[model samples]
Target: MKKYDLLIKNGVVVTTTDMYACDVAVKDGKIAAMELNMDEAEAEKVCDVNGKLVLPGALDVHTHLQMPFGGTVSADSYLSGTRAAACGGVTTIFDYPVQHAGETILGLVNSKKEILEQDACVDYAMHCCITNLNDGEILEEMEQAVAEGITSFKCFLVYKKEGMMVDDATLARLLIRAKELGAMINVHAENPDLIDLNIEKFLKEGKTSAWYHYLSRPEFVEAEADKRAVHWAKHLDAPLYIVHMADKEGLEACIEAKRQGAEVYVETCPQYLEFTCDVYKREDGRNFVCSPPIKGQESQDALWQAIKAGLIDTVATDHCPFQSYEKDWGKDDFTKIPNGCAGVENLYPYMLDAANTGKISFQRVVALCATTPAKIFGCDNKGSLVVGKDADIVIYDKDKDFTITLDSMHSDYDHTIWEGKQLHGYPVQTYLRGQLVYDNGEFVGKPGMGQYIKRSPKK
Candidate 1:
């Protein structure tokens, strides 16, 4: 019998902290060995990855698969969405399973279990959201959820009228409890008073254009909320993660809190890194409308510098998608526009291209797109390309380059915000646990093939 099932030879191996040349051997769905040289006859199958880059499959920790909001469902289901994720070299995703008042959090988990079991094309988990904090039964459910291996909980402070917002008292209570339970709180921080006040003011002035949407949600809306959330978490000494942060003030506040010994991690997205508020000037500006609206180039530059300086912990997509025309809900009223954009499929190539262009080192790209997400969310076996880790890997050509277009993409939407943008490289093959699932833009993995991953591995 052969010593290994598969061997990848002569690739430049990259992890979050280091890069080197190695021939990786795989056996029984795990990385079996890494060495500078291995005998070709030791493996039953061998692929020479000379001149290619071998990196870990990415993890998109924030996505809304088949989510319903603003009178329409999000554009992608779990299968279709993870298919896009697979094609883009992402092998694991942590989607949101929202819980409302009077509902059991695990019940939501049970309901989503079948969808993931029957339709997911990649490994998956969820961060339970407390949509109705006053439901009295939820605090107990939160503890049970942690027992079952979901290590993070999500909360919003900006959707008061929609019943998704939690008051400061409730947020503090949740944070304090999460600290005791060993789970982290992921927050959507925006001062609803500021957001609502600006919206009301704009409506009264008849400034209801798409551009006004960005105007109504200025940087202070996110800044004040982040500062407040940090303050409370600092007081309690609890772990908190601020999601999709786009403002310079918010970043600075997080850095200051960390310096004072608060346990906080912050995430920002590609839309914030690449585009600015100028996107609102286009005829289709409504498509770019999302909560905590994109900032100007000045903020983007500051965010990049912070990321380079190691002030940020993770980078995620917040991949909530809607169709191009879905913005029509707010044609006459900017307040009704569904705030989201599609991004999962673009994470890999966009970051790789950033490395190709000298924007970031290749190792930092791995840290942001794959390694740190697993560490933050408790997927011990899923992030790095190392011995004993799950064999989730990507073989990519550094020379391949292309411009993104709707015709070449895989999301369920008819249009993309990244359409016509250029990508410096693309993945040639993607593997999950030593199994080939995507190649040349085709998905070969079946639904139900992806196993549920609890933050702590089941014994």
Candidate 2:
């Protein structure tokens, strides 16, 4: 009888820590072995991926699909988002779950899983999001969520008007308690005072265009909040992960704290690295509208250096996209336009383009997109190209050239923030737990085929 379910040979197996020219065998949905050569006769199916780059499938640690915000829902549903993720070389995602006022975090977790159970097309997990820190019941539920293996919880430091911001005292308590409960805390680090004040300043002079969105949330707003969050983490001696950091100042805070021996990790999106605030000048610029709006060329250069120097840990898509018409809602006022970009679908290729352009090493791509997220989030079986990990892999055509466009994408959203961007290298095949789910331009995975993954505590 054949011992292995599938074999992939003649590919360069790459990971954050190691690379080997080897053949890998997958059996029962887990990597069984990898070596320079494995007998093809022992496998039921074999793919000769000669001259290809085999990488651990990318894992996006942040995404918002079909989420309600600013009077409309994000365009991608859970299934559509995961499907898009698969086509983009992503195998797993840590999506954010919204907790309504006074709703139990555990209830939100169960309900989200129920929603994913019907529609998800790839493996899914989530970070518990706290909207009301004052509710004692919700506060207790945070501990229960950690026990249930949703080990990371996020609360925004801004969005006061939307009722999502947690006060400084509340943040301190959450940080202190999370450290005790063996959970990690993530924050949307933007100073509300700075942003709100700037918004008033802009509107006072009749500056209501999308460009003002960038003006209101200046780099100082991010820097100030990042320093505050880091000190809170330092005070509790707890681990912190700040999401979608937009400027150099905030990142420097993380670097300083790390030098002081704190466990401070920061993530930045490709939007920040690849584009500038100048994008808002375009006619359809509202499609690119997002929180901590993409900064300038100087910030972009600093961020790229931070990533290359290993100061930045993971690269995630704060992927909350709206349709073209939906974005028009904010045409009268940029604030009314929902804050997000369609990016989970382009996350891998953007970074892959960086590698091809010599801005980052190929190994750094695996680290930023896969291994580090799995490690920091405690997905023990999801990030490495080694024995016993889940066989989530991407077969990439390293030299293939393609242009990114809506016609070529799988996202439910009609417009892409990255429309018309040209790139080299793209994933040709994606495997999830030993099953081929996406193959160039086609999605073969079925709804409900994805399973909910419970994380082990890394605290």
TM-scores for all candidates: the values are 0.97, 0.98
Q: Ten residues in a row with the worst lDDT in model 1?
A: 450-459
Clashing pairs for predicted structure model 1, backbone only: none
Q: Write the per-residue lDDT of candidate 2 for residues 261-328, one digit (tens) a residue.
A: 99999999989987899988788778789998999888888898889999899999998998888899
Task: State the RMSD for candidate 2.
Answer: 1.1
Candidate 1 regions off by >4 Å? Answer: 457-459
Best by TM-score: 2
| Model 1 C-alpha lDDT per residue in residues 305-416, reported as the tens digit of each score | 9888888887788888898778877777888888888888888888888888898889998999899988888899988998999999998888888788877777788888
Model 2: lowest-lDDT 10 consecutive positions: 133-142
- Which regions of candidate 2 fall more than 4 Å away from where they truly are? none
Query: What lDDT score belongs to each candidate, Candidate 1 first?
Result: 0.87, 0.88
